[model samples]
Target: MKSTVADEMCTEDLGNVLPSVYKSVRLSVASPPLLHVNASLLLLTDEALSEVFGAVVEDSEEYQTLKVLRKGGITSILFSRPHHANVLDMKMVEELTTALHSARLDPTTRLTVTAATGRVYCGGHKPGLDAASGLQLRDGLHSLVKCVLEFPKPLAALVMGPCVGVLAGLLPLYDVVLAAKGACFQTTVVESGETPCGCCTYTYPRLMGHARAAHMLLLGHELECGEAQRSGLVTEVLPTTAFHHTALSTLHPLTATPPPALSHTKQLMRQPLLNPLTSVHGSAIMTNTTQVISMARYFAAGVKRNSDNAP
Candidate 1:
């Protein structure tokens, strides 16, 4: 049973549009900075891709590399779980937005997005050094969230491991989120000797409320899948083995909907959150930037001490 549209657009001899169905399960080495752009359904006009690559590249070194790979026709990004922010960065967000915007504008282009990752999506800490460059960092975060919020299609995130910090903070914003059974969602800032992340301050409170949020922030415990769902964070929990099929099953209808209808519906649903995401990001940029810069200095001092001790 072939999808009617897939059958028409993809070559029949290629074994039922399977070839056109790229699953971004690995990262392309060429795009070193960003892990994966969720490129399983990457479809963009050459011109549009170029413009996006150019804009985002100018803002960050990471984006520069990503731009080159995308321009070189590197399609379909599989997640390699690269070390960056626990969540998205300015450049990655911009590129994602550019891809979606182009798809929305192009009548011929259709977009289907499913975000997947390894056992651990992100288990990294943001640099405290960025705190000194608060304004700049804030701008970066602002741009990142704006893109995620504004993307015009069904966006799904597949959580396979401990989703923590910013990644956990942003999960509620996605259209659909599927977590592997036993996978945990953690907000370890308090336990790890760090202040709450910018986004964490806003999103955490909303999702778990002041009391539970305070508990997580103060104690910094990892929430199991059942707890996460009870807290209204994880939407669905599937056994590790069933995650793939279940996610696809969930996304199949989203992919099948008329592009226009999908876009319209998504936009409507997201409309309410738009103002809040923007506002939260604004405060996040300011606070997170300052925190990042300060953290960087502490990191540098620790490095220096370690070097001196070695001598």
Candidate 2:
């Protein structure tokens, strides 16, 4: 069957390419053992953890913003443009959406992991968000989030640094969010006086409670690795040591679970949320696009006035 455990799980152990995130923290903290250490992600040929330093890549093609690495039952989508802090521009968002859709259709794919290069997981929306590009950005992000919400296979995020704005809000929605000890999360939509998109208003409150969600979105309160974990956002916090091996090891258990079980469970759990989140994303996109674009114009004008006065 498509969901057979043997057919869906990773074939090899994960200790080869990755490193430990926190050397002092034990992987076996929970009673039942949170990590099984059997999974390895073909994130990169080398799993080049140093790529987390933001290697400068000249943007050239459709693959510039991110790259896809596939092996066995797992597909890893790495945000490749660390030089830009892995910002989800229209291209990035749309590309990600396409990748998710592809993964959903691929019978061989049992899992999809989204990891970022450099110090940031996702730097948020486009930097120069303006009225002209607002609709495009909104549409792209709306599509991306919708893909994630409906993804049948397991979805994981390898977060290393600052997970901000739209992505900060997205962590709560992923099946697993593995974070480095230094990773931080912050929702910035309200900071710009924009409505929260990516189903954040609906999801965050459900995961962490309304007060905490309001604190995060309304006040832009940042949650460090510990806080995020305590608040139930992160699945695991890793030490900063083993670059690739240690982090990927936690996913070994994914290979143990039957594919159908995971898929069915996810569908069942997310079924109730599907409609609400879809509705929220649609309505929020309209408000988010317009309000954020207007705010961007205001900030730009303010910057111009300050610059002119300086001269």
RMSD of each: 12.2, 11.2
Each candidate structure's TM-score, on Cα atoms with residue i matched to residue i, is 0.61, 0.75
Largest lDDT belongs to which candidate?
Answer: 2
What lDDT does the true structure give each of the candidates? Answer: 0.50, 0.67
Worst 10 residues of 2 by lDDT: 22-31
Backbone atom clashes (below 3 Å) for every candidate: 19, 17
State the lDDT of candidate 2 residue by residue for 202-225, as single tens digits: 888888899998988787777778
User: Candidate 2 at residue 275, lDDT?
Assistant: 85
Q: What does the lDDT read for residue 68 in candidate 2?
A: 73
